[model samples]
Target: MKARTESDSVSAVAALADSSRRGVYEYILEADGPVSRDDVAGALGMVRGTAAFHLDRLAREELLTVSYRRLTGRSGPGSGRPTKLYAPAVREVSVSLPQRHYDLAAELLAAAVENSHRTGTPVEESLRRVAAEAGNSIGKDADSLEQALEKYGFKPETEEDGSIVLQNCPFHRLSQRHTATICGLNLDLLSAVTGKTGPEGCTAVLDPAPGRCCVRILPPDRD
Candidate 1:
């Protein structure tokens, strides 16, 4: 499955904001299997057309998946048209203000722990390696450092000294509890991003400050 983007999450949330659409989605979620529009309409006390409208809307927003199957156990010619059915989508939808990425942090830390157990490398070293690998992957598709940082919710702001200060940390809560570890991972990740896709002679370094990300981007002479 493709990875869900922030816009996709926002669209899903908006789609469910309608009472009828939310009710239709909830009914499908509670079903044992995919349900037809008629089933939803009957269960929710809505008209068939209204239920169908909401179901299609939910499917369009990716909050529900659609399938077509004949309800009756009959063969091709004699059977009626395959009924459209709705089911809960496998993708999870989440939206956070200021745009946190705790899921990404959790994934990195879990991979680091597994790597440490398998190779006898220190957990911190494994974490840095994995985080750098992830950053490199992300950077390869990015056109510039600032674009990459902004895309990941770092909120980069350029300074007069030709440095970038990140105004927001994507892994804020995790860093608060495990400052050194999380900050180190953040620094390594941004460093890799800078190395792989540069704004020319820029470097990522740890420069922790209150109410901001721990990593900063600095020009060659300032680094």
Candidate 2:
């Protein structure tokens, strides 16, 4: 799903690189409802043909959805063909070079926060539990620790001293603001994945380094 989303987002972004197409896209995005080609052309000072061309391009890229509706309030035998309108297709677009899963991280944190509020559990404990559950879910599809890490875009690289370091952090931005919370959540998640793949053989430790995730998976006997 993430891979597909990245591909779609890249295509969508590229489609908007044209000034005319970008203008059409932005106009539709700002509109309260679907916008007609005429409305876009008039609003952006573009010719009708130009607007239609760009709108169709955007629709083809899945950036905008096309619909048909009567411009007049009344629709009957006298009503002509419905006017074509365009609106945003996907509410959001997410693309990252290293394929960060901030949405996944945000979901776990938000759920943990809500559970803590409802059940009187410590926020930290709830976060750990939620992170572990999320990790375990992902681990089910992976046959090995390396496979799981790679799948999630951790870019896992083994060091000379028998330790594994993640070259990229999926929750990079969140970790900067909520250091302890997010890092702890990351540690718990990796620990759960590690346990499922290789029980008692490795552990995730909070060992921050430059341009890397705060948590590092360490070989057994190190912790």
Candidate 3:
């Protein structure tokens, strides 16, 4: 998961505000390591003051952490005072969406993928583990496989054909790098929790509206 947007953070869920804060969120998210405010501005092509302002808000909200450090002094000329760095405090953020009957499995799996890459792991390995972990909790006695999906936030309902439509995404608008990983995680979670192993190559689609993402589950069984 990536840092929450500004609107997201201020909204109900973990989200923040609009894209302005989201840009800073993304900057912290993409850095291979902790970064400075100046670097964030440079990375996002925004002014240093603007970046710092957002960074301060995120820190105030406990979204990110700011710390000052002292570095070795350079004998040359421009050896200034200690520098400051910013790092994402929380790894993931929550977004709200309407519940739909259709379950799109890919989006969830993509989340797992995003998380895996963020932590420097292969996508498949992370997904497999997530699948196994979630699947281990299910027993075959309750509602349909679709019903079981609800426990893991899948919210799936069978469509005209074998398609399972997506109704919600607990994680939305994360960084691009983390996007696919977390989507993958969601997929693995759905597959494991339900023991359906939804079709491969599932993709989560955001419709032409705000806070609307359509997830299409691939065939449960396919080559």
Candidate 4:
């Protein structure tokens, strides 16, 4: 299926607002494969009826899909019946950011710095190198910016204001969670592209819209 739209993202989040729905969606998002409603209930500690309710809603929203499979000949202790499983849908139901909130960069950096400082794992250094390399390749053309960022595994789209709005973050996918380290790296790269920092040692993602975002060049930084 095609990528979900901003509107769809909003709807998806709203649909998951219920605690049960949110748990079900998050569980599915974390799973490696599809599961059944009974399995989902057991995994999430939910009653079968409530689990079925959320499962149906998620399926209706296209956040999940269901299918029946052959049940083992031997039924469970109940000796009642056998059925297929309910699993996370075929697609990952998650939010996409056309633009990273400026705070994200700082938050990521802070986390990375703290973790590296504590563990001495060199994650911070690695992140710095990636940012430096990504920054080095950015150029005047919008296409060039997109290409350069893409090389670093960032899917960036050209914004109307000539800045690039990042659509996909490989780091988030890799980590399977949000962190300050990745945000720090993004902040560095963004700073390099937009020139320099201002009030927050960062810049705002200006006028983010369909396939686009905007940025400003810091006075002392490169244009």
lDDT of 2 by residue, 171-197 (tens): 998888888888888999998998888
Q: Tell me, by TM-score, which candidate is best.
A: 1
After TM-score superposition, the amount by which residue 177's alpha carbon in candidate 4 deviates from its true location, in angstroms, is 25
| Model 3 stretches astray by more than 4 angstroms | 1-15, 71-79, 95-223
- Could you estimate the TM-score for every candidate? 0.96, 0.76, 0.35, 0.36
Candidate number that wins on TM-score, 1 or 3: 1
91-127 in candidate 3: lDDT tens per residue? 4444444333122335436655886989877777867
Worst 10 residues of 3 by lDDT: 203-212
Model 1, which residues run further than 4 Å from truth? 1-3
Q: Which candidate, 1 or 3, has the higher lDDT?
A: 1
In model 4, residue pairs whose N, Cα or C atoms come closer than 3 Å (at least 3 residues apart or on different chains), thus clashing, are 35-86, 35-87, 36-85, 36-86, 37-86, 107-180, 108-180, 108-181, 109-180, 109-184
- The weakest ten consecutive residues by lDDT in model 2 span 1-10
Backbone clash pairs in model 2 (N, Cα, C under 3 Å; residues 3+ apart or in different chains), count? 0
- CA lDDT, every model vs. true structure: 0.90, 0.86, 0.58, 0.57
Question: What TM value does model 2 have?
Answer: 0.76
Q: Count the backbone clashes (under 3 Å) in each candidate.
A: 0, 0, 42, 10
lDDT of 4: 0.57
Ranking according to lDDT, highest score first:
1, 2, 3, 4
